[model samples]
Target: MLFLTSRLDHTDEEVFKIKQLRQLVEKCDELCVGTDDTMLTKFLHYTRWDTIKAYQAIHAYYEFKRRHPTWLARHSIEHYRPLFYGTHCRFVMPHVDRDGRVLVIFKTVDGFQRFPDYLQSLVEMDDLIFESLLLLPRVQEKGITVICDLQGTTRNFLRQFSPAFMKVVNEKNGVLPFSQRIVHIIQRGFLMHVTSTLFMPFMNKEFKERIFTHDGRHLSKLREMVGYESLPAEYGGPASNVLDTDLIFNHLLQNADYLEKLQKYEKL
Candidate 1:
């Protein structure tokens, strides 16, 4: 509760708005005092302190989860080992950035055959990461910064970027509790630009502003924005090695017990 009040200097109108949002969210779904305060605050902040919009966002968030039971259910790292073993998507840098947002890297390679299943795995990984962050009181207020490394991406890989995949991405981007600080697309190519432009209409102005595109020449700019030390070794940073599937899988497994405790606490 102190974290909630400390983050923002609320005016009389804002206080009333927060109270209204809290009541609405609680009516929509049971909220634990410890956990749901932060969750409620996120929705309100995302909607720019607009109670009605926050209510809509809260409703959409839970609705999306309910519709996708596979994404909503309890899933551990072991459950996703096979998918992780085959992909390079993982949360790198054990710490948050200067702005306190968690750094996640999705290195796209050229061997994914089933995009839908892979997309689900990505969603599951995000759920685990976000849930884990929620458990850590210090970082609960932080958002996520996704660095998409499309280095070796080929035409085949780009083919999987279909309308269905884009729909899922847009839907999740719209409703998640935490804000997306940036979806930094590095090593940008023609396909990246083309696809992003095509989907630009789907994103709000705020989200569009957060979508930064950088080429190889702009490594310094990328470093400046995200901090050099937080990046992978391949990106000219201090991280000794690039984060692969195995490293992420192990990291998730290591924190499994703590994450479970936090999740259970939220339900209480």
Candidate 2:
């Protein structure tokens, strides 16, 4: 169970986004961020919350992960996002285990709630998010993935992604690859957007391309790919909830097609 996140929201806006993130990551059962302890202290030492919330964020993720230790199989957490207006993006992607949690955070936020108002609240108040949800024991859970997009981007790409995303933004369609930040914020919202990409490989592909094209210097984009839902809920897993799967389909949409393809590939 690989865990990834994007710190698109620079504003300290909500709590549920992070908490809801906890809920979604229940699959990991052992939350870990994308950074080392030294860096984490340096990053949050200057913040207003005095890094209390920062510590909470880490503990929250770990506690959530601890709940279902058996569910996690492959997990990575990318920290940070590429900012067009400012490189000092306040939305610290945090120190994740895999280092990719930042991007995963961004991907989750954009795909889920479409970056709704509720999501921002989570970032502002981390515990509220957990409070909002009716959580059950690890023994009782649902097969669902919940992501919160605290950052907002109203980009035109939401309407017209390439076959890798929407099928209308392909080079043949005459839609140029405009600056995604400009388009996503204008179309989605400066600090709000959400959706699911498990069943949406095109979206994930385009997202990776954006990382490679926009922030390649600071961040490294992976040439390889993996999608959730293709994994078994119980393979190499603990006897936790089916919802506590090693493979987590983030945000909103599930990757039925990706799952199907994985099966075919396995057979071949």
Candidate 3:
């Protein structure tokens, strides 16, 4: 939406394809979204370089934004400061895995004490973080790997995942113009079973298959998949590696302008 010049070096054929895709986008007068080569390239990559599918994905993307105005709005730092400043539950790592995919981690601390009040804000904040991550050229190219750390999770936290919220999350994940390579769930006990029962129904077949469950003792497997460099010290990475909530928050603040511009693309 910000119309960034593509940093991704494109091959001749890819450049040609992007031009073709751009034409399709321009022709759709109703879309009203101002996208650049980089954004178009992301759609191409998301649809595996098929011009038609990329256009369709673009249409779906804008339609999604139009449908969810609340999520699309309020990406500025001031809007999120009060609600999410101290919240460290979800953030993208500053590192990438061996295959270059970005790492996104979500941990449940205690359940939200004010669930209903924070639900919309929480969804918008998560979208802000995710959208910021997607703006990175490398992240768009390589996609993302999600780490669901359910270590400190409790039944209370689990209960906060309402069906309506899960449905919106599923829809958001589906329409977002990025790939979710895999989701690694780190948990223990019967809670994982209960958690699975509660949320698995909302997931599509491909996403469900992408999830790999690991018990507390099986962190080694997680390390093997994500690599030590990509993880935090708490999860067995280097001693210096840590989850810096401030860093994530600061990054979002830095991109506030970009996020603000994105809101304009939504159909009123």
Give the number of the best model, judged by TM-score: 3
Q: Per-residue lDDT tens digits of candidate 3, residues 1-268?
A: 2223248477999999989988888887778876687668778888888999999998888888888777665656677776655556776677788678878888766536754555566667777877777777776777888888777767766767889868877887788888556888888778766776677899888779888888877689889988988888888889888887776677778878877776677533
- Which candidate model has the greater lDDT, 1 or 2? 1
Candidate 2 lDDT over residue span 7-41, tens digit each: 33434433333343444334343433333222233
Please, what is the TM-score per model?
A: 0.70, 0.18, 0.88
Displacement of residue 224 (Cα, Å) in model 3 is: 1.0
lDDT of 3: 0.76
Worst 10 residues of 2 by lDDT: 134-143
CA lDDT, candidate 2, residue 83:
18
TM-score of 3: 0.88
Q: Order of candidates by lDDT, top first?
A: 3, 1, 2
- Those runs of model 1 whose alpha carbons end farther than 4 Å from true positions after fitting are 1-56, 67-74, 113-116, 239-251, 254-268
- Top-lDDT structure, candidate number: 3
TM-score, prediction 2: 0.18
Per-residue lDDT for 91-119 in model 1, tens only? 55665555767677877655447545655
Better of 1 and 2 by TM-score: 1
Which residue pairs of candidate 3 clash?
none
> What's the true lDDT of residue 192 in model 1?
60
